[model samples]
Target chain A: MLAAGLLALSAGSSAATDGYAAIDGGTFRSVLPAGPGIEQVDVAPFRLAKTPVTNAQFLAFVQKHPQWRRDRVAGLFADQSYLQSWANPVVPGAGAPADAPVVQVSWFAASAYCESVEARLPTWYEWEYAAAADETRTDARSDPAFRARMLSWYARTADTPAAVGKGPVNAYGVFDLHALVWEWVSDFNALMVSTDSRDQGEDPDLLKFCGAGAITMQDKENYAVLMRIAMLSSLQGAYTTANLGFRCARDGDEP
Target chain B: MRSIRRLLRAMAASCLAVTFSVTAQDLPDDSVYQLQVPLRTQADTASTLDRWRGHPVLVSMFYASCGYVCPLLIRSTQKLDRDLDAAVRRNLRVILVSFDPDHDTPEVLAALSAKHGIDDTRWMLARAEAGDVRKLAAVLGIQYRKLPDGGFNHATIISLLGPDGRVLATTSNPSHPEAEFVAALRATAVASKTPAAP
Candidate 1:
């Protein structure tokens, strides 16, 4: 009976590893409002990879699922530049170091990799909630110093992304949420919409967006987070950028 | 009873075999139908994005409870249908998949189809799982976000797909359907009627 129970536990917790850290979630006040009259989003507890997915990890994924290889992937799922940094279809050499976060990846490719590991891309709210922390405090967005540090990273351009886990861990014990690469969220397309038609009053663009008003920015001063939202919203599923990468998340209580 | 169960099992196995063969043989690598998403139509029938594979199709995403613009989307499609020649119309299909699958059940989709007065023979209203809905929207380049009021904010886009499921053209202006899009639809429909060129 004990052996059978152990087998079931191992099956249920496939991605259980030291690399994944538990994030205790709660009401998070994101820069973008959840919707009309909804200022705070209720995020559920989940596990997030301690660092961004590395080139080596993604190399393993493509080796297993040849359809997702840089050459074999369909044009409908990824653009031509997808995995352009890799040395070859199966090799992540030189420019794409094994320890470096995988860049030039489309949302579809990133999601497929996460699914291969029995995980999924974190939702926008979950990412924001986890990213809102510093080394000391969980909700450190109010701190000018924290905001300044994050802004500095955005302003600095680098030819290649630094290795993951090079920065300090956050209050949630997760690293490189900000200072690494711009990550992909599952609902990247759902981030922004034009302002409500009712507010504009007989605007010609009303027909463009249907139903309730679009999401309005709550914290206008939070430019770092706002820029991330802008970049993500502008991307399509098949688009791949030079610095775009992703990490995986799992649902249910962290074990 | 034993014979009936065995017969049902055999039928199910044959259906699975047919599905696998279609997916493996005919689908193009870049076709939106490459997405293996299952959908349910207004008639409570299981369907897929490739149901009208051999014919030109007009596809869009909308929520059944959408108050204002969704109805306009339906009218725009109907106008496009009316603009086409009867012969071309007979060869074209219209599919509107719901972004809000939780509330837009098969029954709700059927009601919306009736309310719009669409010809069920050529027009299909369908709903897919939430994850599949997102994937379909991404492939169609449609954007949608759910509001706190349970209503969705979404783009109004109708895409024209060739007989092979590759996107041919798209129009976002529901108020005024583009003549170019109509012409493209007619061209694709007429082309589909002809035998393949060597």
Candidate 2:
């Protein structure tokens, strides 16, 4: 019995789901608004990619050539080629590590990959929970220093994206959420503070969107944040880039 | 029983929306409007496009009605803004060219910025005519279509324009965290003489 138990323990370690680094923070409990769209997403403690997706991982998606990849036939501009380039498979000769996060993938490509793996991309709130990695402990939402440091990587020589945990993952099992490639969230289009579509009579369904975790109490504060989410949401799967990447998530049991 | 039925209905609806939100490729890119505008920008207003000479520009296209993707586009631009220092911020500016020409006026943009408190002074929201909007979209290989309900079925193309206004990097979804814009900006900055004004 002891021998069998030991063997099982070792196997569990090998298959252990690593990636969650729960931040040392609070139980920010709140209720979702009672509306048609808002719903509670009890994101049980989970793990996420601490860093942005990488070129190597994206290369693999290119081989798969999922529906997201649009072709770059000559003379015609490659529409969002970066997202699909990996989906397009550059040399096919290039070898990629399966464990590496996929970069240059649009929210569509990333979402599809997560679905293929029997998972899903995280909500913007969940991504933040992981990215904040417990930094929700601090009250520095407007720290200019933090924002500056996040962007500092752009000025450096990113010959190869540094390995995960090169610096650190936050409280959540996620690492490099702040400094590496921009990550794609499941509700990557959902913005917290404001909505531009509501201003223009684009659709009566303007406020009625899919993938909202909550009917947020207040509008989001920054167009900057709205802009980021918009960019992520607008992309097709065929896109990829040196800096764009994505992480994965599984809907954990309700917390 | 009625409450349970309502719950089930909401669940079904949420699933359907999530399905389309996560899985669909049908978002508008408006490639139909290819290169029809003069492709002017706020940068052009402050100085000649020649200031950067051959530097590259990262451009974001959006309309006011798009409560969903438009915010994402702005967020992506903000992400690019987040990566820049004050000096680089000065050299690299994210262009927000309004597509909801019917709604996104200069005053509207200024109000939105004031409302949202978007910081990067380098980020400018340009107001233009719908025809010019189509032309600019064409030149940069961006796509957008006016929706039947007045919403747009638009291409979410964010391009890195060479300072000479040559298109450099065209990012798909041009709205996410803007990794393409960030990378293209860095690459363009390195590849330019003066680099465009902040």
Provide the DockQ value for model 2. 0.02
- TM-score of each model, in listed order: 0.88, 0.39
Instruction: Report the Cα lDDT for residue A175, model 1.
Output: 86
Query: What stretches of model 1 exceed 4 Å from their correct place?
Result: A1-18, A194-206, B1-29, B194-198
- Provide the lowest-lDDT 10-residue window in model 1 chain A: A10-19
| Top candidate, metric TM-score | 1
Model 1 chain A, TM-score vs. native: 0.89
Regions more than 4 Å wrong, model 2:
A1-46, A50-101, A134-148, A151-160, A192-227, A233-242, B1-198
**Which predicted model would earn the best DockQ?**
1
Model 2, B69-138: lDDT tens per residue? Answer: 6776676567656666544555565566777778776667767666556753455666676534543554
Candidate 1 per-residue lDDT, tens place, B58-110, comes to 99998888887788788877987887776678788999999898999999998
**Candidate 1 chain B minimal-lDDT segment of 10 residues:** B16-25
TM-score attained by chain A of model 2: 0.56
Q: TM-score for chain A of every candidate model?
A: 0.89, 0.56
